[model samples]
Target: MFRLAAVVAAVTVMATAVVAQTDVVAERKSVMRESGKYFYGALPRMLRGEAPYDQATVDAAFTAFADSAKKIPGLYPESSKNAPRTSDYSASPKIWENKADFEAKVAAYGKSIEAARPKATSLDGLKEAHALVRAGCDSCHDSYRVRH
Candidate 1:
């Protein structure tokens, strides 16, 4: 029957959308986690001298962080504001309510990344850049995301 076919098609479409949305959440988390591995993991180890201070690694990490920054705004589509399957930060409703402000925060985050990457060529440089990156993340988290 046409009605049965229509129902099946509708269900398939909705299921596809849900899968896509879940993938978006996974991707967004992956991007952030990639940066975190650099920021919180590698950078600290280098700072403490627990790991060798490799300028190349520092530069690469910051560059990667900046690359992830470019992908930030795109990752946060309206549909991504809710993903029941993901343990990602429950992004605040403020992102949807005042999208302009949300976008402005993202711009600021990018600016910080730009400032941080170049400064990451040496240990002192990397430390300074790390501070800026931390400040930038704190600012955005304070406004746009809910901590759990």
Candidate 2:
């Protein structure tokens, strides 16, 4: 009876860990998608003059990027590295192997957002800042993302 109880408890713990890890992966993907909406959608149109520059929209995008920078490192706990469920992109195991470098890139991204937010008030200013911000993203992705 004791052995059976121990087995049941172990299974329950494993199941819970799996569920938690999956949730982390989903949350990480959702955060990235939020930033993608701005990057792949309205922001570029505004930059190219295809859409009118809207301060509120720009502000919202910066806010989303800032929030993502803060949350991303935490979402990548070791357990979530091998979560059974993932999106088209998975975090490279390099993130765990070189955690410091991965986190430094995220920190740089946050700094870029902070420096860029004020400049975003004008079209040209936003364009210049956008390059800096995009560089931060590319730096991290180049090292840390696996394209599925």
Candidate 3:
């Protein structure tokens, strides 16, 4: 009976660990999705050419873009071995398949946004910056993300 109880306890502990790991993965995926939304959703608004493309808007959008980029490397799973079989994930295994290429694009994106930082002092300046930043988004999404 004692042996049986020990076996059951071990099984329970193993099950709990698996559940905890899955929860962590799910949480990470959720955060990655949110970051993608902020990065992509802001682009259309910036492109509208109607919003006050002032310093504040530029600062906010650029800050958000930078934050989102920082999260990208973390969000990408180390391998496709554990990737979800089916879900709303816009990211593709191609990202991991060509990890170096994907990472390079992400780095270029950060550089483009950083370059726009000093030019965002006024509406016209912000508009120009918006264009540059939008281009970066287009570049990455074109290569890495799938529309759903």
Tell me, by TM-score, which candidate is best: 2
lDDT of 2 by residue, 103-130 (tens): 8999999998888888888899889878
Off by over 4 Å in 1: none
Compared with the true structure, all predictions reach lDDT values of 0.83, 0.89, 0.68
TM-score of each prediction: 0.92, 0.95, 0.67
Per-residue lDDT tens digits of candidate 3, residues 45-137? 555664444455456666777876787676565543354434554566577778899889889888988988788786666667767777887
lDDT by residue (1-148, candidate 1, tens digit) is: 9999999999999999898888877887898888889888999998887998898778778777788778888887888667774564667878888888878887888899898778777778878989999988888888877767
Candidate 1 residue-wise lDDT at 61: 82
**Residue 58 CA displacement from its true place in model 2, Å:** 0.4
Weakest ten-residue segment in model 2 by summed lDDT? 79-88
The prediction achieving the highest lDDT against the true structure is: 2
Candidate 1 overall Cα lDDT vs. reference?
0.83
Which residue segments of model 3 deviate by more than 4 Å? Answer: 1-49, 79-82, 85-89
When 1 and 2 are scored with lDDT, the better candidate is 2
Of 1 and 3, the candidate ranking higher by lDDT? 1
> Local error of candidate 2 at 101, Å?
0.6
